[model samples]
Target: MNIASDIKPDRRERALAALAEKPDGVVEAIAGKAEVTPAEILEILPQGAAVIAGKDRFIDIWSEMTAWGTVLFIVHTDDIVLEAEGSLPAGSEGHGWFNIHGDSPIGGHIRKDNCASVTFVDRAFHGRRSCSVWFMNDKGSAMFKVFVRRDENRELIGDQLQKFEALRDRYAAS
Candidate 1:
């Protein structure tokens, strides 16, 4: 059964229509205007656009991401979006938090226990192809997102893209 089937049909149709009209729009925003959750929107995305993996794989996935080179890490709330461009630092679990501390500018303590799933999204954003790894909480909200960075010509960095695709494929199968 479709995970979002419980939503009213009219509302689901409206959300689908909106997504079709604006495929690159921020999903959270689209879901908000349509009175749906971001995870629900993701569930209905065009085939091949999104793949989900259980949070049990978070550590392995995060470990691989540390080698992805410079990328964009985004943390957002209802009012603001904060972005950091750097290599993801290696992290370790201690005292109920995942401590991320290394030479990179990205450092913090993440509540890894709260992460419910990891979703790999390959889609367009602002008219350009983009790829991101979304860490989602149980409430259907994104805890944060790690986006593959674009180069000077506004193209996804090839190495990172390969790594991202490989990682997605590796996890999507299991």
Candidate 2:
């Protein structure tokens, strides 16, 4: 989210700063299954999900003090991982394909070829710590990583790994 103004600050940025003042802008999350609007989600979302899910950025020490605004920070990552929301593999709709062809240098197909597991990975959950989710494509060559906490990201990485293996049972392989 872009809160930076060439000359001065923006309105949304000012509002976000005020929102973050106490207890980290308390009460900004939901449980069970629910749909949310993009506007309010900006405040409640955890940092990692915000960034990875393309939310605002807080990249500096005096970041919030000065800029203190949050709209959406545009980041240039080496590679962008697109989510396959509510879809299955091979059977999915558009895009989300890996470069697994013969001429492609990024060889090694995504394994586990279980369509059911693929769908589950795309689904987010109310992880104890946070919404922990790891998604490996059908071929399993590479995987996408996400966690609620940066330090703990590695901690539950194993759990998610195991969950990946176990999720095959949760859904019938498509």
Candidate 3:
């Protein structure tokens, strides 16, 4: 299910629509059921539910996200889903690779060549309005996702939400 090759376009769209209706729908689960990648699900999201930003513009978006304070960085595999909650470190780029390291445990050598696109998904999860920034690989599978984290009371962080919306609006408008 890493690729949507086996799924019909209409069936993929229907899966996305069904996922949208669930408050705590799991994108990976939906993608699995639809025989598609989570990134593919994001790609087919209805208008206003998501925004696409080309990989060429990712540097600018990455810069903005690095300053977004603490967030939830997720990296998943079939067996495990690792989540680190902290701020995105200031990354250094050299030799076509971006290296990130800081107080957060989400440091890695990001191969820019594998980045295919970026998607901003403004959707509800766990009964709350949430947003995720997904980095897709060349195969259109998500390499990782950076999501807005909530406060101690389990409430959404207004400032972060605003920033997410601003980023979405700014990029979508351009």
Q: Rank the candidates by TM-score, best first.
A: 1, 3, 2
Residues 72-103 of candidate 2 have per-residue lDDT tens digits of: 11111235534321111121112433223332
Worst 10 residues of 1 by lDDT: 1-10
List TM-score per model, in order: 0.93, 0.21, 0.86
Judging by lDDT against the true structure, name the best candidate: 1
- 1 or 3, greater by TM-score: 1
lDDT of each: 0.89, 0.27, 0.78
Candidate 2 Cα errors over 4 Å, as ranges: 1-9, 23-49, 52-129, 132-158, 161-174
Model 1 lDDT, full chain set = 0.89
> Candidate 1 on 49-69: residue-level lDDT in tens?
888888898999999999999
| Best candidate (score: TM-score) | 1
In candidate 3, what are the lDDT values of residues 45-127, reduced to their tens digit? 55766687888866788889988899999987788899998898888888889888888877888887688888888886767
Higher-TM-score candidate of 1 and 2: 1
The full ranking of all candidates by lDDT, starting with the best, is 1, 3, 2
Candidate 2 at residue 76, lDDT? 18
